[model samples]
Target: MRAFKGFRKDLTCLGFQFREDKINRTEEANCVKNGFHCAENPLDCFHYYSDWRNSVYYEVDAGGDLDEDAVDSKISCTEMRLIRRLSLEQMLFEAAVYMVEHPKRQWNYGVKKETGTACNGYGVVRGKNPRAAGEKGDFLLILKEEQNSPEIEEIALINIDGKRWHPHKFYDAYGK
Candidate 1:
């Protein structure tokens, strides 16, 4: 799939605060690792990295057939960019949990349960049986061409909520 090149500059994250002490060597190194120069303004730090398409391609469940045991699937670059933007924006604004849908029948993302007008109905509840259409995993993002390693796995598994669920466990349980 082609990489998403455009990032909506207007979609700046609002109300983000940076810690003064956290801006030390480790933070600077992380900034460099994420492809940015550490700026004096904390807003610059947030703005620079806020673009979802900056350094990684987010992995999604992309719900598959019930007969087979897989939900991981590829999404279009456009959909990826939008989902990233939405996730970051929602994370910053509402601080709520968000889940991205696998691209089986369609591509979309939503918050688990939201009272805010903007975040309502971003997700659906599951029945006794798990379905790809309703699979909502953590807001995991993977680096492009990331080699297999524990470090890579840890980095890819980003927690989007207080509670966490691995997509694989669902398939493993139901596939049996």
Candidate 2:
């Protein structure tokens, strides 16, 4: 089965180190003891490893005997082959879409802000929000604001040079 797996930034999962494009297998397939685990959706990975900054996710194929979660898409298998790693944008976009589709689960997502705006490349990206018709670029994302309070974690946009900035800093620099 094709699945999404979460691992440490160093590519370690369940105390085992894995390399890209390599197949790793265990002699046993016990979900509670010795088995490989993955989720069908990338977001479900947060359930296992919540530290986004330090965790990396990959696309993989899981074989052998499997145990599936009744509540979610998590699966435990004896064999796993890493397909490739996923990009941060791909992961964050999933969270973004989840934030929009499940507004009631906003607190769980932890990114949408309670204001009207477009997240830019300057504050978040180091450039202004794209304003031209059908203009596409590297980082600007337009999201409908979720009305709430000051508790939601603002999404940070990183510049090409590697500095991370938040939208509030953008407004502060340019006067919102």
TM per candidate: 0.17, 0.54
Instruction: For model 1, name the residue pairs that clash.
Output: 61-71, 62-102, 62-103
lDDT agreement with native, every candidate: 0.23, 0.55
Question: Which candidate number has the best lDDT?
Answer: 2
lDDT of 1 by residue, 15-127 (tens): 32212222111111121122212222111223335444442221111111111112212121111112232244333222211112111122122211111111221222222
Per-residue lDDT tens digits of candidate 2, residues 98-157? 444554442432222322233232111111221211112333333333235222223333
> Residue 21 of candidate 2: its Cα lDDT?
63
Please give the distance, in angstroms, between residue 1's alpha carbon in candidate 1 and its true position after superposition.
Answer: 8.6
RMSD from true fold, candidate 1:
17.7
Per candidate, the number of residue pairs that clash is 3, 7
User: Which runs in model 1 stand beyond 4 Å of their true positions?
Assistant: 10-138, 142-158, 165-176
